[model samples]
Target: MIYDLLIVGGGVNGCAIARDAAGRGLRVLLVEQTDLAAATSSASTKLIHGGLRYLEQYEFRLVHEALAERELLLAAAPHIIRPLQFILPHEPSVRPAWLVRLGLYLYDHLARRKRIPGSRAVTLAGSAFGAPLAGAYRLGFSYYDCRVDDTRLVVLEAIDARERGAELRIGAKLVGARRDGDVWRASISGADGRIESVGARALVNASGPWVQETLTQRLDLRSTKHVRLVKGSHIVTRRLYAGDHAYLLQRPDKRIVFAIPFETDFTLIGTTDVPFSGAPGPVAIDAEETDYLLDSIRHFFRVEIGRGDVVWSYSGLRPLFDDGALKASVVTRDYAFDLARAEGAPALSVFGGKITTARRLAEHALETLAPFFPRLGPAWTAQATLPGGDLGPGGFDAFLAEVTRAKPFLPPSLARRLAGAYGTRLWRFLEQARSMDDLGEDHGCGLTEAELAFLRAEEWARSAEDVLWRRSKLGLRLDGAQQARLGRCF
Candidate 1:
């Protein structure tokens, strides 16, 4: 089959493009070298904000676009994505009060917002939100954003794309491709060493960090654009503070780090912008980055935490468009597409996009290639809910109550987790089962055989890590024995 769009990566941008393309009545095929979101997509700070920091760099347009998508996505996938508030503690030593307020004001007003509340000033002296902070931090600002299961978002996009007539080939690496008359003939290698040759009318290089390498090494094409790889690392520690709200810490270096609630029991602290010159693959958090995070945390909270307190750490490379910025943090988070055609089908290479604007990036990608396929349908994903995201107007809280009421056998926590993860689609698997025994073998930390089977057969979860680490953070709760047993199933 000569696919209308053949995407080269399966990150957020890639899966999102496949979803959008398929919904537009185009024949789309998305190929991922590993499991979905095994790379950059899973490795994000996991916020759907407008990048308040970017406003300092005068990226008003990017901030506005991201903010608009923030509300749009909130309505689209209210299941996996939840509204979160970040408290920015006042640090006069870092910046004055007026400047911070102005930035916050701009952040709130940069774009049209409905579902999320705007920023507000707060007294951190005796409030629950300020209980974890040191004595000096008495004033702060609270603003709204969102948290998402980054990997599931990608998986859902792939699922939505597949349901909308797109083909997905996970664990398939794009080996190479060449132009042929009106189509692009490509060779792809599968996980079991099987090579498949396919044809596509056009191609999309959404290879995230490896965009440059994929262009040169796989397709043997030259590009004037460049990709700068920056590493962002996160650490999972025991809950640092109380309350569901997250803390946005301001650094002396004019950088920001977040301490968010993770897995209901742990705090997700991360994301240092370090220049990474190493190879592109699974990366571990650096010691300095850990120290950087630890020091930053100690500076604010009156809590005892060090490297020993660290439980789990992960790192992913951010494939930023290298515009020769001195500091890695300030690099543009905005994405760009380079559409090229040399007397053949078009190939659009994507560079530098964040999860917040992935849907918009996909829309713009199709727009960039609009001339190549004039008969493509119009954009319609803005109002469309992803697979299982439709909670039937009752919202997540209402849906969770309904799930628990219907399945009296399921523990409240397990029911809540599964409902949030799968949304309205929880019934597809749970509807037939009436009791815990029917759900299958019980793995510790709420994982069951029935859930594992659902992940493997429905979602493209091939390994234990895909279910534990990517699909959900249940890996943090599972022991080595349980992990090994789960791994054997895959």
Candidate 2:
């Protein structure tokens, strides 16, 4: 079948575009070389934020659009997207308190924020939100942003795309493409190493870190601009703070690091920006980056954390648009598209996008392709709910209550976690599980064989890493032996 649109990458931007296009009555096909979001999407800071630092660069338009989309996404997928509060400690060495307040003031008023609370000042000594910080810091600011299950967001988009009549192919890499008159003929190699050909009226390359590689090497397309590869890494450790709020610590070098409350019992601290020339996939946090993160954490927190405290660490390469920026930390997180059309064929390549801006990027991408798909349906994804996101605007607590009533035998923590991850779709998993025995053996932290099967059947989970690292946070709870057992089971 000749698809109306063919999307390459299967990351957030690609999956989002596929969902939007398919929902708009276009026949779409999306191909991924690896598991969905196995790249930059899953390796994000995992926040649906407005890029608070972008305000310094006068990126008000990007920040406003992202902030508006934050509320829309929260309403659309309350299961995976929810509001999170962050504490920013005041440092005399950094920006003045007045300047910080002014920037946050602009940030709060920039977006059409309906559900999230605005920023407020707090005394670090007496406020509950500042108990985790060092005693030297006595003043701080608290603000709101949304947290997301970045990987599941991508999977849900792919699921929504499939539900909307789009063909979704995983582990299928785009090997070659050529313009054939009014259409583009693309060749994709599946996981089994078998190549398949497909024709499309238009093509989109949303390959995050591999954008330039896909265009230059795979598709033989050339561009004057290139992407600068910047690596950001995160470390997970046992929870150090007492409260539910996260922290945004400012380093003396003018960089900010996030110390977020993670997974009930742990804290997620990260992300140092450094130039990288290594491969995109299999990116690992090196000793230098680990030490840098630890130093940053130690600088602000009363609790000291060394390498011994780290239980897990991960790294991802950001495909930033190279504009000769010398400092990796200053590189812009905004995105741009290169639309190429040679008479009858068209291909649009995307570069430098974040999880927060994916939906808007899709809308703009479709707008770019409107000339080719002249008769395609109008844009409609802004208000559409992703798969498993049809929670009827009910608050999370209300949704949890409904799940608890349906599965009385389920432990409160497990039920809440499942409901948070799967939303109303938890019903499907609980339909056959009447008792705790029906949940299968506990693999620690509520992970069970039944849950694994559900993920495999519904969430396109093919490997243990896909389940542990992406689909859920079971990786932090499970040890090496347990991971190996899960791998064998898969």
Candidate 3:
């Protein structure tokens, strides 16, 4: 069978494209060399945002589109993606008070905000948001974005694509491909060390950081544009504050840092923008980046944070479109595509993109290749929901109540975590379990055989890291021995 589209990479953009194209009745095959969301997608700041900081860079269109997508994504995946209020403590030194208000005003009115509330000023004194802040901070502003289980978003997109008849091959690397008349002859090396040849009408390179490498090395195509590699790193520490709201900290250098709640027991702080020239692979936070994050947070939060306080740290590279900005932070977060259809068998290479607008990016991608496939279906993902996203008319809170009532045998904590991770879909696996014993071998935390089996059979989770780290952030709770046992099960 000749697939209508062949995609490379399993990051958010790739999965989103597969989901969109497959839903449009196009036979699609998405091949990822590693696990879904194993790279930059999972290492994000974990916020589905319009990038308020981008306003300073004068990226109005990017911010507007992202803000619009923000509301749509929240509706599509209510369980994993929900509204988050952000508190930006004013540092008069950073910008004049009028400028801050003006920026906030524009952020509120740039796009039509439906579920997310408008931005407003807040007093830092004697308020919950100000409790952990330094004495110097007296005023702040609050606006809503969202928090998401980033990895699960990618997995859900891939799952949706598969359900729509898209073939997703994890642990499969594209050895190379050549344009043969009208279709692409692609060689893929599977996990079992077997090579399979397939034909596709068109090819898409959504290889996030590997976009350039895939085009040049595998397809033997020279890219008309270049992607600037920038490294962004994050650190996990014990909860820094007492509210559900996240803090946006300002640095003397004018860069911003976020301190948000994570996994119910930790604070997620991050993202240093340093130009990266090294080959894209496993990246870790360096001593300098660590110091920078700690120092930036310390200026606002009264608590003293050091290297010892970091429980877990991760780093990922952003393959942003080269916009010739002197600073990495100033580069545009928007996406672009280079279509090589003039040469035969339309080959589209994706450039810079962020999680906030990956769905829109996918829509535009299909639109770019529409001429080749005249019978392509119209765009439909905008009104559709991803797997397990429909929480009924009552939304997540009511859905949680319903699960709790139905599963009286489940521990409250376990029930809440399962509902948050899988939403209404947890019933598929939990329906047979009557009590704690029914869950089978405890892999530590609340993870049990029932959930593990579901992940392995359904979610493409191949190892403990996929289950503990990406599927759910229980790695923070598991010990070394427990992790090893869980890995062996997979």
- Model 3 C-alpha lDDT versus the unseen true structure: 0.92
Q: Show the colliding residue pairs in model 3.
A: none
Global fold similarity of model 3 (TM-score): 0.99
Off by over 4 Å in 3: none
Residues 50-123, candidate 3, lDDT per residue (tens digit)?
98889998999999999999989999999999898999999888887788889889989999988999999999
Tens digit per residue, CA lDDT, model 2, 346-451 = 9999988889989989999999888777687898988888777887756788889988988898889899899889987777777788898898987777887788
Clashes of 2: 0
Per-candidate TM equals 0.99, 0.97, 0.99
Local accuracy by lDDT, each model: 0.91, 0.88, 0.92
Q: Candidate 2: deviation at residue 438, Å?
A: 2.8
Return the TM-score for candidate 2, rounded to 2 decimals.
0.97
> What's every prediction's RMSD, in angstroms?
0.9, 1.3, 0.9
Name every residue pair that clashes in candidate 1.
none
